[model samples]
Target: MKTNPVIETLLSHRSIRKFKDQPLTEEQIQLLVESAQAASTSSFTQSYSIIGVDDPEIKKQLRIISANNQFYVEHNGFFFVFVADQYRNQLIGRDHHEDTSVLDTTQRLIVALGDASFAAQNMAVAAESIGLGICYIGSILNDINKTSELLQLPDHVYPLFGMAVGYPDQDPEKKPRLPHDVVYHRNHYNPQPSRDALDAYDQAVRRYYETRTGGTREETWTGQIARGLGNPYRKALKPFLEKQHLGLR
Candidate 1:
């Protein structure tokens, strides 16, 4: 397959859960943020904020909030929480005596989420390009209220996700992804995916887990999805958003 430097960097992506004891230089952090800022935003809203966590106590609290298993949250060279933010925009609107009710709409919330996700991906790619490793921590939502209070996030600002970046202490193998035919379609959507392709990909994922875990754990992609969706997780997410004065519509 043809590959360029950017493509190679993307294909080599792995979630680094372990990191060396070194911390990132201020210059590196600035570059990462600049890369994230360069990401496209909806209607130029730029509805996002990046919070860098450097306080040890705060990191410890966040580690606990993240289930206390992901030590990388506290041990990484740098940690960032990408926030879906419209609070700043709302403040601007208030100062201009304009109605800010639109900021609370679901459409605005989705826009902010998309903006944050795009920025996070840009930062992830930039980190990889600079020979650094990164991992996204979605468990930050496990205790949404606590996370919000911990970060002192205001209304119209939600902690979308957290990322840990650092020099890698381990190099794990890349997990297999869904086959192209299963995900890609022509001009129209494909209601029926290729079962054969899905089965092959499941087997590949099972093999990956087995190899990575020394044959002790073998799970397929479908199985993982089933387990994840079998029970409702973060049932308070909607209420939390409502409390934050977002996603009302």
Candidate 2:
């Protein structure tokens, strides 16, 4: 396969759950944020804000809010909460005496979400390139209201997710992904995917888990997806977003 240094880094990406006890230097933090800022934003709105959690007490609280399962939240070099924020733009519009009703629309919310995600991915790649390991903590959304309150977030701002970056203490095997044929289509959408390819991919994923867990886990990708979707989680997300004055339109 055609590759370069950047492609190698991207391909070798792994979630580093175990990080060394060392905290990140301020210089490293600045570089990571600069990389995030370099990501493309929608119409240059830059409708996102990154909150670096340095307070030990706050990290403990966040670990609790993450269902108390992800201890790495409080033990990383640094933690960041990427927020989908339109509050800044709202203030801008208010200062100019212009209508900011558009900021509350679902369209603007999507734009903010995309901007935040792009920024986070850029930071992740940059961190990896600098010999740091990172893991995305989406469980921060488990209790969005409590997270918002804990972080003291304001109206028109929502905490999308958290990220923990630090020096690696352990190396884990890369998780298997869906096959190319199942995800990539030529032109039109391929509603009917090849079952043979899917079956092979499922077995590969099952073996990956089995080997990773020493046979304790042997579930396939399809089974995992089915279990995840069997019951809807976070039903309060929509109401919570509306309460934040986002996606109200």
Candidate 3:
């Protein structure tokens, strides 16, 4: 099968959980930041900033707050927190002697989030291209107040997510993905695929799981989603989002 470089890079992507305790070179860090800045911004606002946290003590505290994942603090050499920020623009407005307080709208917040996410994904792809491992830490949202206090985020700025980067310690098998038709649509949106289509996908996922995990555990896509949604972690996301001054009326 013939493939382009971009397709090949994207197809082989996986989240690297384990990493070697090696520091990233200054050149590499600069390249990552440059690549992140190249991503398209919403209305050219570029409402995002990345915090590079290298302090061991701070990393340790973040590790505890981020689900007690010691790998984040002990293993990874560099940590980055991506923030959705309108604060910079607020300052721009202040310099121009204009009001910047009206940026508290839901639309503005979403735009900032979109900008941050685009930049993060760009940096992740760039890191992967250089044989570096990366894992996104969504669990940073688990304690919004503490995270905000630790980062000293101003109003109109929120930590969207975090990324831990280093050389891989181990390479796990690539997890299976849903069928293309399930996610891809034609001109317009379809309700969903037929039950038979979903069943075929479930069987494929089940087989993939059996082979990948050496028959130790089995799971279908629906079952996995159901299990995840059934947990208490699912309930707190919306309220937590609200507490962060996001997604409000």
TM-score of 2: 0.98
**How do the predictions measure up, each by TM-score?**
0.98, 0.98, 0.89
Candidate 2 regions exceeding 4 Å error are none
Q: For model 3, state the Cα shift of residue 11 in Å.
A: 0.8
lDDT for each residue of candidate 1 in 155-233, tens digit (9 for 90 to 100): 8899999999999999999978899998899999999999899899999999999999999998899899999898898
Clashing pairs in 2: none
**Residue 82, model 2: Cα distance from true site in angstroms:** 0.4
Once superposed on the true structure, which residue ranges of model 3 sit more than 4 Å away at CA?
207-216, 232-249
lDDT of 3 by residue, 1-249 (tens): 899877777888888888887999889898999999999999999989999988887777777778784565546858899999888888899999997655766888889999999999999999988889888998777777677778888866788888999998878778778777788899999896767777888898898889878998799988988898867753455665565555465
Judged by TM-score relative to the true structure, which candidate is superior, 2 or 3?
Answer: 2
For 1-249, candidate 2 gives per-residue lDDT tens digits of 789988899999999998999999999999999999999999999999999999999999999989777889999999999999999999999999999999999999999999999999999999999899999999888888889989999999999999999999999999888989899999899999999998999999999999889999889888889999888988879999999889987
Q: Considering only N, C-alpha and C atoms within 3 Å, which residue pairs clash in candidate 3?
A: none
Number of colliding residue pairs in each model: 0, 0, 0
